[model samples]
Target: MALGLFWATVCLCVFVAVLSLDIMGFFSRGNKFQVEGRTVILTGGSYGMGKEVAKLLSQRGANLIIVARNVDKLKAAIEYAKSHAKNPSTQRFHYISADVCSEAENERLLKEATEWNNGKIPEIVWANAGSSTPMMWLESSIETQKQQMDMNYWATAYLAHKTLKAWLYPQTPYSPREKSAKAEAPRHFIMTSSAICFYSFTGYNPYGPAKWAMRGLCDGLRQEVLLYNGARRSTKKTGQEPAPFDINIQMVFPGNMKTPGHELENLTKPPITFILEKDDPEQTELAAATAAIKGLEAGNYYTSTNWLCDVMRISALGGNPRDNIIKDTVGQWLTSIVWLFVGPDLDGKVWNWGKKEGMPELKPEKRIAR
Candidate 1:
């Protein structure tokens, strides 16, 4: 009867609606971020926000393996991680000395870490290894631009690929425990890209290009992973799921940050070595240096106590970008449009961890002792 057909249709629609909601919720639930009990390998962990992240992770009972070129600082950071860790007995902290810019070093670091952990491969690898060039026009020598590209973009891309291919891939040497874990669950890949990957700045010079490449790297990698995941899901294959390898990439646009000098001795060297002159003595050199040191102590980009935390919070809460005509044109016409559109969203998405609000006044304990 017509009445009976209508009732059946209504029930079918309700069931479909409920199923849709459940499906949407399933994807949404997967996207949430959580960090605990994972083994994390962080480059540039000897200094700056990288060190702090490692410390925080250690507190959360995550094992840490830190890498940087400086052996002494790496050891110090490992000690710091151990000291700050909440459950030292369960946490594992190791330091590998390597220049992240070097492909060989990156490979060695990944292989050794995997081997050293008794095949307990790191679940998360943080490619936070970076060095900034002096802000200048792109007119600087080719060498300067090359260094920026190598240190920032190429180093980041190389390390990221190595981590994904070397450690995350199944065919490569895998620990027995890791293989068993993979049989149970997949892994995640995280990258610390910049918000600058979105917009252009007046002073970026060669640095902007380097960051843009990183943005591209993340986008391409994300798309590739999505495709792989989709293909795996679509396949009629039913048995055990393939290792769930997901790429979680975030381009963090931290405003200006007060980062400590990695190589103090190198900075102290003559300006001639860097192909640039030092700021005039009467200029605001001392004030600039002091402010940078203080900013790091306060952990503020602007005035916020934790710049990164604020960025992450803002990213969570949707925000809009200032529609600058010139910047928008540059973004749309010159570079990758995807990042240009997503850059603003990504700016505060992960965590600023830079100087956004004015930095806080430093107390004695916060001050770097001479």
Candidate 2:
């Protein structure tokens, strides 16, 4: 019995070491964006991955507008950027305390950003605010589920729509003609979605549905933006009346993250208690989770080191992915029977940190006729 226990402890240690190595590999290959003099807004920037992204953009001299529900946290984040930013002149930062889940708050936040910039619209907007309910299939509370849906689905959709509409309308001092002349500069709307969108999980009751909805919303909007912009460009070529806007939308499907909220102690409470036990081998897996979460949270899959390359490829290509492509191709399943009998595949589709190389390049392709 003593020998068996010793071997078990050794095996667990080895497994953890391997997991840490895999996660570290992803971080080494992370794609860092160099943006300067560009206006970028990030929701949930008060802490965790959002704050890190703000710090990154600040370092690159990008004007930042950080949003979160906490006013104090937002202020602190703004202060941090002010202190850490390299070229403060090139990076003007602002903060707006609002809930991304509320439509009124979304409109108010965008309006505030524009107003703060003297009516100049932001060139890059990242819809990165999200809340999760990691409850078992049956244990999720009504309030938790509703909040997740609001933050994860409706809030994302509302903010995306508002941001796109604002981007489409020509701003003051820059008329439609001036904007059209600079066609090469694509306006970006980066949606922070999730990889669970590609597959279902027994542990994800409400959160999965909301995230899946975000994927659908992104796909639909992606097609619309392409169609809208394509028609405008075609009209310009024919010397006819041109359509209004040229917008490029990018959707991101983040995996597990290591935000403060994702702490194992917090997750082991209330809603998440059923899904995660303190004694589980993967119970306190923060580094792996951070790799997955930070990847999508960074506004691109490559940012997460390479865990979500497949989803990013589909988003950039502007093509509808067949349902269950990730699940079928990668074999990710989280059904009750599977979870109970097979246990979580810590290294499979749920946590693929090395697949970033397979992501499709972001080269622009000629638009196909509708």
Candidate 3:
């Protein structure tokens, strides 16, 4: 009877151990970053994908500071975002009319975010402002190209720089309670790049290179964050306290969306460009915003509304995060091969129809009735 009791006790201990591990696994699966109550400073937040993101974050109870160049548009966007807020009485919606591309403006934006709400700094920063003019590299001016780069690449870099500096520069030793609080609140930076950063079509000269630079910037930022993680782990392994750094990075490569920027870009696009998007299902600004939010909730490093677009990024896989390791490796090579064939066909379209029609700078072309 004593022997029987000993065996039963062993079985009970095993069962308890298994149950504990399962519970730990559930919480450690992945970081689910929710936007609720987090201060989110979104650039280009007045229109297009930015506007939609504001609405979604507002509904989720995020305190917002929308940055844009236009005051009138900012006011309208503020009203729109507030109306969608889960609790308008409590949610803070403020607008900063500043050109985020400028260095001074970017710095000021960060200062405001830190000082807002009685010294509560922003936990989430969304670099979602960019515009591209549809012109071949040879046809585009150097100044216009530089301006585009300022908006697309420089703005993203500025925001990342500010947030990373803010985190790393203020590394402080915390008490047990402070350490627990730090572990609970992680910082997130999401930058909006373009799928063209991976694969470019014809007439995407200046824009393609500018967006490609954004991807490069994101890669560098994420790698630096990983380095911080490595140092923290190394310190902890040495039985010393790790430096306080808990940050996550996400790069968004969005496809076409129905926004003012999209419409304006389409006005100057080649006929082949129109042909390419004709078959794809309609995607709106809200849809793109929804995908971004969902990606954040899922803790994905790369996010996009279109599956093909996401696959294209992984397929390129230069410095991008792998999808699922083995699955992503296979998918990358397979998709790369398929694109090898599709790419040349697209090149043919460029060679065949390379006319620049419907440019607003030039007079409208007269169309004859059939």
Candidate 4:
């Protein structure tokens, strides 16, 4: 009798959970990331997931400006985006060659993009330009660490800062009449972070922290935007013309994408790092970008491109908002329970690797002077 009662309760819980999820799905039906006829600035669009995202956005009728340092690749990416445009005659595509790692260049890119868009700031800005040079903490040079931070964290920060300032504090403030004349869709600022931000392993000392910093920035901005959004809605009482539209701050956490950047990363990846992440699933650039866009449309703040990344994300959610509170709460509990075992298991692997392989030897050129 007790065994039957236990089974019955389990089935009842499962049914309730499924029913709740279905009901939530019903309420969240419409696409939140509507981009038709909007202007978008996409950094690092010359290759990898950025290029794939540009193509997808073009298909959705967004006017695109792709930015990268390589002029040849930028030209190719623009042509590719133009070819996939939904309205070939109406949609426009352009490319800019600039190193986004430089703060001045990021500002210039946004200014140029605004100018190109007839003095209106882009509705969407995606900071997807980043690089990784994975190595053990001591094995990596200080210059390499700084470079990783510059590319992964500072570049995104600089762009987000300039874009938000332009969006919220426009030089020519919106008139009350202007604000009421048109109901604008929410503006979106997206940053690309790595799954390593959630849980890092050996050989990612230089890269992982930079990605983690991006998560911190995203979390803080997500909360900060709420203040501006609230103030925008209370314009009558404040007697101030609010921002043109509500701002949406989001981040994408992608894992193991098969791109040219991934190939370059592998060339510097340590052998132990390979063993640790050998089981991780790799996605084609298109698959990763598709998942990211789907998450955006679903109104997810922290979008994970795969199941593993989702698990990692929930495990380290910290102060980030949960897209589905009930689902994320349950997942978080399960992940916490699982990590009790996973954490030790990963540590054991690292220890065993050291015992089996001895200390890793640095190349002669990599050695610091005594």
Candidate 5:
């Protein structure tokens, strides 16, 4: 009878948890990311997931300005996005060719985008240009490490700094009463990070740290934006002209994607790296972008593109905002318990690989193709 009662209690607890999650989902059903009739600037939109995101945003009625280094690819991407526009005649689309890794180029791109939008800054800016070169730490050169950081972290940081300054500290400040309804809506700054940001593996030494830095930047800015958003609500008491609108900082953690960049990354990936991540599922550019857009619309601060990415994200959530506090807490607890065993298992695999293969050569005979 005691055993029977224990089982019944466990079942009741599970039922209650399921019911609570259902209720939470019901309450959060409405779309929080409203992009209709808004201007959106998307970086690295010439190909892959960025291009897919641009197409999705066009379907949702956003005016698009896609930025990339290749003018021909950027032109193609713009045409593709325009073809999918919800209101083809009303929705406008343009492409800009510039290397975003340069700080001056970022400033110039934003200025041109603002001018194109008729003196209004874009309502949404997504820093989606990033690359990876996977190799052992010792095998990778200092130049490769610095290039990784510049491409993945510094590029996004530069664009984000310029965009936020324009949004939060405009030269021509206007009172709350002077802004229109469209201008009063929240602005979004989305950063594209990788699943490696949450966990590091052997072959990612050159690339993982850069993504981790991007995650750190996102976390810090997420908290700092709260101060400005609060000031917007208390403008009367502070007697200062409020910033135009609330700024929402979000980040996307995408796992293995089937893109040209991913293909290039695989050319340099160590055999051990492949073995470690073989079980991780891969998503197409469209699928990954679709999942990211869904997460944004659901108002998630840190969006994960796949189940494995979600697991990694929750395991290292730190101070990031939770999508659902109860759900995230439960997930964190479960992930911690699983990691207790999984962590050692991974380490054992790496140890066994070294024992079986011995030390690999410092450099392979063939250099990675650019």
Candidate 6:
């Protein structure tokens, strides 16, 4: 038993040392990518996190193509972008007002953006529009659920579909010369999936599942974006250079923020949710945007602010991951079991909430308190 314990200790130490090195990037991918002078199409850019992201990128000399359903707000966003840009003389800003949930609208936005930018595909395409209607799953209508899917999932998917054609797909004989001309210029596709993507609370309901679906899609898309090994070998065998596969996929899972929508969500949020969120009321939009930019520049495959989000993210990595490995599959299972046990109790509390004196309906008839 003494010898077995000794070996176990040694193995654990070795594992920690390796993981630590990987986390420190001693054995990680190069993070030399730059956002400077890049053209970007940012959805939901009128206000909140989207507006903040635009400001940060503009300050770094990136051109902005801001989109949202609010023309007045989008125009203001463009003015902000222009004034703050590192090189205002060289910077360009455009605004479009369209509902991002419409695939046709998104397609038109993409077309107009590319055309306005002198036929240059944006270096970064950011899907930042998202919404949540707070209610229990049973209380939320199917329309409410579908609205979440449209904004959080389909919008991102449509953007990725259009952008990746220019960013990822390798050139063929039939490929357009203009597309093949520039070896993919390290394009970035950024999507905003909430920290709730990792786990859902009682009041979050459909919104949580919608975000989870978005995260799952991002994971699968990350894998699918890989340039085929066969293509790489074939190029080398034929003494031809392989096309550059510089498309970077980044998904940010931000914690609660002091956005307008957040205020709207709070009216119906569960008492238990506040207990779980126990952190300071709101992480400023600026702070969240800063963390996101830093993470993207550092090549983090998964970027987040809250401790809970990080814990859940690190715990979800598989046999192969680009970074973050605090524990293995077995440890993750154990951790999940703990949450699983806690989950039912949370539900029970919620169930009892309904039975309490003057309890508000999960879908309160009047959302905001007068």
Where does the lowest 10-residue lDDT sum fall in candidate 5?
172-181
Q: Which candidate order results from sorting by TM-score in descending order?
A: 5, 4, 6, 3, 2, 1
Error of 2 at 364 (Å): 51
What TM-score fits each model? Answer: 0.61, 0.65, 0.81, 0.91, 0.92, 0.82
Q: Is candidate 1 or 6 superior in TM-score?
A: 6
Clashing pairs in 5: none
Clashing pairs in 6: none
Error of 2 at 36 (Å): 0.9
lDDT of 1: 0.56
Q: Kindly list the per-residue Cα lDDT of model 4 for residues 1-370, writing each as its tens digit.
A: 9999999999989868786876568657689999999999999899999999999999999999999998989999999989999999999888888888999898888888887887778899999999878767887878878988999999999999999988877763321123454658999999999999999899899899999999999999999999989886673666455685799999999999888778777777778889888898999999999999999999999999998999999999766688977668778999999999989988888999999999778762142211
Worst 10 residues of 4 by lDDT: 172-181
lDDT of 5: 0.89
Q: Write the per-residue lDDT of candidate 3 for residues 1-370, one digit (tens) a residue.
A: 9999999999989766765674455434453667788789899989998899999999999899999988999999999999999977788888888888888788788777676645645778889989877665655678768977998999888878877776655432111112432554667898999888988776577688889998887888888788776765563465444446578888887887877787778766655667665665557899988888877776778886778677777778865776345446767788888988878877766665545432334433222221
In Å, residue 131's CA in model 2 sits off its true spot by: 1.3
Compare the candidates by lDDT and give the number of the best one.
5
For 71-93, candidate 2 gives per-residue lDDT tens digits of 88999989877776778655588
> Each model's RMSD to truth, in Å?
13.7, 14.9, 9.6, 3.8, 3.1, 4.3
Report the error of model 6 at residue 52, Å. 1.2
What is model 4's C-alpha RMSD?
A: 3.8
The all-Cα superposition gives candidate 5 an RMSD in Å to the true structure of 3.1
lDDT, residue 186, model 1: 38
